[model samples]
Target: MFRSIRHRLALFTYSWHAIGPASMLRNSVRWSADAEARAVDSGFDARYGTDTNADLTPGEADILIDRHHAATMYLPTMDQDLAAMLAALPWPESLRRDATFIDLGSGKARVVLLAAMQRFRQIVGVELSPRLHLAAVRNVERVRDAGALVSPVRLVHGDATAFDAPPGPLVTYLYHPFREPIAALVMDRLVASLEASPRPAAILYCHPALQPGFHPSVFGQRDVFQLAVEGGRQTRGFLLGWSVWTNDAWLDRTTIPVPLVSGAGEA
Candidate 1:
C-alpha cells in the first residue's frame, strides 16, 4: 500500500515538472531510483543481472511513457513462473521446434534470453528505448560469454510499429508493454504480416490490459487462464492469454475460449 502511494506520488510529481515544488519532488524520486540502481553490483539481479526497474526517470523515458501511452515506466524482467507457463503452453512439439519467438517491447531482453534457452529456432527482441536496448545487448553478450544461449537471438532497437514478423510459424509475446493505441498499431502490423505470408501465428499476451483494442474477428479461439505451480515454492499466479491463427480463411472466424491453466480466467 505504501509503495502504491509512493508510485502515485511520483507520477503526480512527475506531471508537474514545470512547477518548482513538484520539480523538486520529481528530482528526489529520480535520485532515489538512481541510488537503488547504483547499489546493485555485477550480476546483482539474478533474472537479468541488471537493475532494470530502477534508475529510469519519467522525463528520460518520455517516448515510452508518453509517446506510446505506455503504463510501465521502466523495463521489467519477465517472471520465472511466467516463463514456465510459456513453456507449458499446449503447442505441438513440431511447431515448437520450428517456431520463431519474438518479444515485443523487450526492454532488457529477459524474454528474449528465456526464449533462446527454450531453444526456439529463432529469437528476436524489439525495443524502442536506445538506453534499454543497449543494456539488452550487453545482457545478451553476458549470456553468450557464459555459454548460455544455443539458439540464434538478436535484439533490434526500433519502435514496435516498425517491426516485420519473420516468415513461417511464429510466437509473439507481449507483457502489456503499451496502451491501446500502440497495441492496436502493433496488432494491425501483425495482421498485415500474416496476410502477406499466411502462416501459423500465436500471440502470448501477459497482463493484457488493452486486449479489447484488438479486433475480435482476427483471432480464432483464445486460451485464458492463470498460471500456478504446485510443490516446493509457488511463484505468484499471473493471468495470461493466447490466441492462435492460421492461414485458413474459415478457421480464422472461429472464436472460442479454451481455459488451460488453473484458477479463474480474466478478459
Candidate 2:
C-alpha cells in the first residue's frame, strides 16, 4: 500500500516513452518499486514522464536486477502460464542433456536461477549492472547453501551490447528487456561468435518486443510462441524465439528445422 499521498499521486503522473532502435521499447518507464513488508509484492509499474535516474549499482543480483528491470518496465518477468508454455516447448536439443543456457540482460538472475534449479548443466547470466550482478551472486550462494541443484551457474557484469556469446551450442534468453538497437548489436555479436565455432543455437524470448513475424533472416527458421495476458488486455504478451544459424536455408542448400545429416543432433 502506498502510505503517502506523494507516492499514490504517481498513478496520475505516470508517463511512458517509447525509446527504441528496434529490438524492444527499452528505457521506457520509471517506476519506484519497493519490495519491503510483503512476502511477494511485485514492485511498481509506472512510467513517470522520462525516467532520469540512469543506472546505479545496488549490489550483485540486486543491482543487475535493477538494471535489467529498469531498462524496460515489464513486471514479474513473464507470467506463470507463459513460463509453463516455454518449459513445454521442444527445445532444439533435448532437456535430458545439460543444455548451456545464457540469460542476456539477466537482471537479478531470477530466470537463470530458476533454470539452474531445473537441471541445466550450466547457466550464465550477463548483466550490465555490476551491483545487480553481485546481488544475484549472493542469492545464488544462498540457494546453493540450501542444497539447490548442482549445476554451474555464473553471473558476469558486462554490457550486452558487445558481449561474446559462448563458443558452443547455447540457448540465448531474451525478455524483450532492451531496445532494438542494443538487441541488434547483441545479435550481431552473436552471429560473429557463431561464425567462428558455428555451433547450433536457440533463443528463448519472453515478453519480447520483437513482433511475431520478426524473424532473423540470417537463420533458416525461428520458433516463436505468443501467450496473451488477458488480465491486462493490452498487447502485453509472452513470445519466445529460437534461431539456429547453421541450419539456414542457404547453408548446405536446406531450409528446414530438421537436424543436420552430419552435425545433426548437437552440432
Candidate 3:
C-alpha cells in the first residue's frame, strides 16, 4: 500500500511540474494577444468616439469616418479556407463585370485585401472602428510592399448602414458584422439601393446568425449557400449567401428580428 501510494504521488508531482510551464505559456500567449488588441483599440478610442472621425489624407481625398469600439470586439483575420476561397472565386467579369465587392462592417480590411488580390476589380471596405481602419490600410500597404497582387481597397469609415453606394452591382460580404437591430437597418438601406437600380445584389456572409432578418428586409428574398472545403482548418463553419431578388424571380418576404445565439436576455 505504501509503495503504490508513493508511486502515484511521484507520478502526480511529475505531471504537475510538466503542466505548469505549458499552462503558463498558454496564458502568456492569450494575454499577449489581448494586450495587442487593447493597444490598437485604445489608439482608436483616442482618435475617434462612437461618431465618425475624419482622416488626414496625403492629397485631395474624401473625408473619412472612423468609430471606436471596445477591445472585446477584436476579431482575428480570415481563416485560410475562406481566404483561398476568395482567391479562387472566378474574377467576376463580362457577364458579372458590374458586381462590386463590398465588405460591410469590414474590420481591418482583411477580407477586402484578400478579395482584391484575387482580382476583384472594384472593391470597397466600410469600417467603423478607427484603429481597425488605419490598421487595415497599413495591412494593404504591407501586402503591396511584399509584392502581393492586391486589389484596389477603398476604405470608408462611415456607418455602413448608410454608406452611399456607387452606381453598379453590389456583392456585400458580411461575416456576422453586427447584431440584428444594426444589421436590419443596414440591410434595409442596401435593399433600397438595389430597388433604385434593379440589379443583382448578393451578400456573401461568412458567419451569418441573423441573416434571416437581414434578408426579406433588404431585397425581399433569401438564399443560403454553404461551402465546405476538404482538409480545411475551419470546422463546421460555412458561408451564408443572402442574394437579392431578381426581376425574373421575385418573392416577397417579411422581415423578422434575429435573436442572439445565447438567448434574448444577453442581447
- Cα lDDT for residue 237, candidate 2: 39
Of 1 and 3, the candidate ahead on TM-score is: 1
Local distance difference test scores for all models: 0.60, 0.49, 0.50
lDDT of 2 by residue, 51-133 (tens): 11222222212334434323543223433423553454445335424457788877656666667766565889887656566
Per-residue lDDT over 1-267 for candidate 1, one digit per residue giving the tens place of the 0 to 100 score: 996676667655544442346444535545354334334422335654543444343445545545533534454543543465565455677887798998888887777877787667899999887877888888888887777788899899888888999897787877666655677678778877765556666666554221232443323223212122221111222223433333333224433357777757655
RMSD to the true structure for each prediction, in A, is 11.9, 10.2, 17.9
- TM-score of every model versus the real structure: 0.63, 0.58, 0.53
* Per-residue lDDT of candidate 3, residues 155-256 (tens digit): 887677778777765667765555456666776677666566655455554432212224344333232211222122222332233222233222123223
Ranking by lDDT: 1, 3, 2
Query: Sorted on TM-score, highest at the top, how do the candidates line up?
Result: 1, 2, 3
RMSD of 1: 11.9
What candidate 3 gets wrong by more than 4 Å, as runs, is: 1-72, 81-93, 208-267
Model 1 gets an lDDT of: 0.60
